[model samples]
Target chain A: MTRMNERLKKIIIIVVGLLMILLMAISFGGRERITAVESQLGSFIAPVQRFFSQIGNFMDEKTEPIINVLNYKSLNESLAKENEMLKAQVVSLTMAQKDFEELNDLKQSLHYVERSDQDNYISCSVIAKDIGNWFNMFTIDAGTEQGVTKNSTVINGNGLVGLVYEVGSNWSKVISIIDHKSSVGFEMLRVTDDYDGILSGTTNYELVGELYDTQANVHVNDYIVTSGLGMYPKGILIGQIYELVDDRDLFLKQIKVKPAVDFKKLNKVMVIPYDEYEEEITTYLP
Target chain B: MNKIFVFLMAIANFILMSTLFQQFRVYGVLANLCIVFSIIFAILFSEQHGYIFAIVSGLLQDTFLGKVLFVNTIIYIILIYVTVRIEKIMFKGNDLTPIFLISMATIAYHLIFFVFMFLLQSTIPIHQLLMHVIIEVILNSVIGLFIYRVVFKNVFGYKLGDYNA
Candidate 1:
């Protein structure tokens, strides 16, 4: 009986091991696509994740004030003395603000903001994020509850963050532009005549892109903004060209970009409420 | 009672690491608490317990963030197996044994993850990725030292030599 049981255990272990490998191959190897039904079943985890995410957010919220108090405890004594020291500094800061506004105007940012119409944006907090060192994916607190749909353009004060990919009742998953699958259409705002390019994120958390034509003069720190061809709103700043690399494609000038938004410290974002999509219809030429 | 405590602690750790830890980065690399827990389990518990935790935690991670399924699951399984194998052959009853194993596991887990990611997306730079994996390994190892001491030695009262084969 003992020998028979031992044989049976070994066989069972072998079968299970094979099944695990098969599952891994199917998923990671991308051999067979996960069916929609299976995907929907997988999404059943959303609510549970949302619950834990809320618990985490609650803890953070409760802890932030205490932390702030501890940090500012020493600062409190120096406040009055610092206030006297900072009075003249305020005038310099005001002048700096004016200079910043002038710079913004030079970039035609006001025009971009006017065209983009920020009124329809829904404010949301990040409740959870991708469970890895890669901050390429995350979840937001607002979802269908706040009328957030898939593919909404997500942004923060820094620049374009990413787009919503999946949505549930109260939460949604956001795939940042740094993810390998993400791509964005952008134009150089510094070049008024504007060179265009398509930007894609790499596994190394960097954005690499190619301009439509190499004729346009590209410089370091020249800002790139969305071209507004797709779901993205017009002129949303993506990032600045960090370096000009060798063009791999004959049709485009390859370049590297430094994304404006800090992917790691993202806490809040605004999702533009737009569901614009093009569906072309055709008929057989009878 | 210990099993229940471990299960709850795992859940709490998962939630904290996935969400709250984003705001608190150490040297631009987020500490992977899931990998840390699974390594500890593989070193301290029986194989069955270690395997179960690995799968459960791996599935949660995949379901929430994974575009392709079973990637995290397979990685966790690989890490656990490596951890178990290392534990059997290493010198036990040392203060640094768990820390050393955790560091090895961290490196192995990330190396495998990067290898798979490179297969999926061929654009990843090898040297740049190695730097990232190294940073994470060092960060996780430093954290594992304190965490193991508290959770293993003080809380669980686990001996320095608790490897079950």
Candidate 2:
């Protein structure tokens, strides 16, 4: 009986081990499917995310006043500067709105192309940071309840922040461009023309890009923007080229960029709820 | 009771490490206090207990990171096994040995982690990698010493001779 029990225990352990291995393999192999499942799961847990976000907001409310009280003079000066900036932004936006109205005629002429580019965006505040060391992910106070979904492009007022990798009912996880696995299609906005490239993150807090051999005419301080790829909309500011390193052996040039958005100080973000050129970009990739 | 307490403490330690300690990055190198604790715990406890703690710790790490699921489990298990085996041989409860062991283990863990990351085609620079290892070693050792004094000595009533006897 003892020997039989020992054999049964061994069998159970082996079965469990095999099951674990199989699960891991499936998780890695069917990554897209797993991601889809995670997004689906997000819809179910949106309310929980909302509750957490509310808690975070409550904490912030309680802490902010105390912090301000301790440093009132500095806080006042900072608030005044921020107010001035906000006024300037409002003025620019008002002018842009007017220009948008005037360009309605031109827009009608390019209706077919412009129609697809139109999208709805929702703004949400950062609720929490994801608990991890490897990936730079954060949870935001928006979810499927607010129409946020997986693969949604998230950005701050300044520039791109990241993309929604996973979403819960009221919260979503954003995989920042700083994450090692993240890749973005980018372009250089020069005075004359736009050149395309692929942006990747490095160990340092810098976004770097590898330009195509033909369109390698990039210089330091050149503005980088998201290419009008299916994943991201066109003309969105990415960063400025800080350095250009030439790889003689590979005949390739690497452009280091300082992202316009400071992720460390991120408070609120806008989620582009729809993919503008999804079909076109998917067709281009394998 | 002891098992439940240890498990809860490990979870709490993980939560604090991920959320609180993350804000205190020095020149882009963060302290891995959890890893240090795992090592110390494995060294102080029985081999079976160490193995169990390692698995729990790894699962806690995986849940937080959302990537590299089994990597932590496998690594921690190996680390605990090695630490326990070394403890059995050396059989000492000295201050210097714990510090040295922690420093070595911390460096080893970072190196092994870097190699795995490299295999996965991560883009971490060599200089930053070295800096991370050094910083983690120093921080973990300092923190390990304090934990040893407080938890093992004061709370648990563990002495250097506990292992041998």
DockQ-based class of model 1 = acceptable
As for candidate 1, its clashing pairs are: none
TM-score of each: 0.71, 0.73
Error of 1 at B130 (Å): 1.2
C-alpha lDDT score of every prediction, in listed order = 0.70, 0.66
lDDT for each residue of candidate 1 in A1-286, tens digit (9 for 90 to 100) = 9799757856765676567556655654222223554346444545565566566666767877887887686788689777886898799879989998898797795465332325657898776787676447887777677888777889998889898876666666778998766889988875248788889887565799888877768888777888776667677888878898865557567889999887766777898765655421211110
TM-score for chain B in model 2: 0.82
Docking class of 2: incorrect
DockQ of candidate 2 (2 decimals): 0.20
Q: What is the TM-score of chain A in candidate 1?
A: 0.61
lDDT of 1 by residue, B100-160 (tens): 8888888777777776666666334566566667788887888877666665665456755
